[model samples]
Target: MTSNPTSSPDPIPNIATASEAFHTGDELRERWRALMGPLGFSERLLWFAFVDTTGHILPALNQLPLDGPPEPYLADLLMYRLSDVIDGHDVVSVAMLITRPGADAITPWDRGWARLFTTAADLAGVAIEPIFRANAVDLVQVSDPRADGRSVA
Candidate 1:
């Protein structure tokens, strides 16, 4: 008998677990609250991967998949890859967030960041956004000034 080269085994190593599945906003909100806990700017404020969609990749207290690749482990690599995609013409589905020092706030987009975000979104073909509220502000993107049909910031 010939074994199939492209077959997933029972214990598929790369398959997403139930917990690894995409999280809804509500579910993520609960998780975020739990993560935030009672620490008032005491714990590290960072943006772990939320729903990285063409819509919005929220950077806040959100339900992290109990089993997804941790942010730090993939941040640098993800950024480099994203840059390459923006600079190159490869499979351009991109979404990500950055960690910063704050209290349940996202790293606001500056002029430099706006350029990066705008470029990435344009190259990404479809669309991608980083969503988060800062210091009780309503949800906002990285605050880009350009209207590239992508960076709604």
Candidate 2:
């Protein structure tokens, strides 16, 4: 902790000290959503991932609809998990279509998503410009990425 004029301090690693910001942010968003409740965000949105020739992954906005929610949905819920599925190939872009909240409310919930996508691009060592159209609240109150069989009571 040298503040001497002749010495400099080490730069804080990661974006905006966001090394742990993603998870902290996710928790914050979850709590915010819970606090706002009915006055906040919608329940569902669209999610799409694109894969390049090499099988690299990038999520994108796809109008094409699948038969239903992703399999093993854990009670019809969409897992916002992408870290494990977006590498080793040629991913181009990812799109998450969020539903507009009834009001003009924009929370920091976007931070986590930003972190995930940014990390992917960083690892891939490419510059990516993301286009955002819309997004919905990721969930009501479940914080665990793999928490299964939830009961809304």
Candidate 3:
């Protein structure tokens, strides 16, 4: 029996360059879909909402849940893989919800999340400033139209 190379599988494309080639939100979303391949609605929603006007990072923050648990480091790793898409640019905004004074105090969970975000930012070599808020409602004022676009309401 002859081995068939064509019937095997195609090599995965390099994500760095693939992400750099994205020129719009839709392009980024498509590339993300290609990379993630069968993700959940939350994951898809996160990627779609985070791509910026130029199809880059800042927009991604808008997709994360302000009050939910931290996503695994893999998600951050994937974001870092797209570093070329926002290298040397001011991209990524980390926002935290604070309900009261001194509510921004760091906890074990916060430390873990910080490590993920910081590590991803370092690997990506981009700016990811943290924004602390007094409440979840504060984020509503800065809502993304693209995020709203996905809303059925």
Highest lDDT: which candidate? 3
Q: Write the per-residue lDDT of candidate 3 for residues 36-140, one digit (tens) a residue.
A: 432222221232223343434332323444245556665476556556554334433222221212222344444445455555655666443332222111111
lDDT (0 to 1) per candidate = 0.34, 0.33, 0.36
What TM-score quantifies how close candidate 1 is to the native fold?
0.32
Per-prediction TM-score = 0.32, 0.28, 0.33
Candidate 1 lDDT, 33-131, residue by residue in tens: 333333233222234433333323233322222122234433344354445444223322333323233434344332344354445445544344433
Q: Output the lDDT of residue 118, model 1.
A: 44
Lowest summed lDDT over 10 consecutive residues: which window, candidate 2? 15-24
- For candidate 2, what is the TM-score? 0.28
Tell me how many clashing residue pairs each candidate has.
1, 10, 3
Report the alpha-carbon TM-score of model 3 versus the true structure: 0.33
lDDT of 2 by residue, 1-153 (tens): 212346553223333221121222333233233322333234433334443433233323343232333233321222234434444355433323233343323334433443444444445443333312232312322132322232111
Comparing 1 and 2 on lDDT, the stronger one: 1
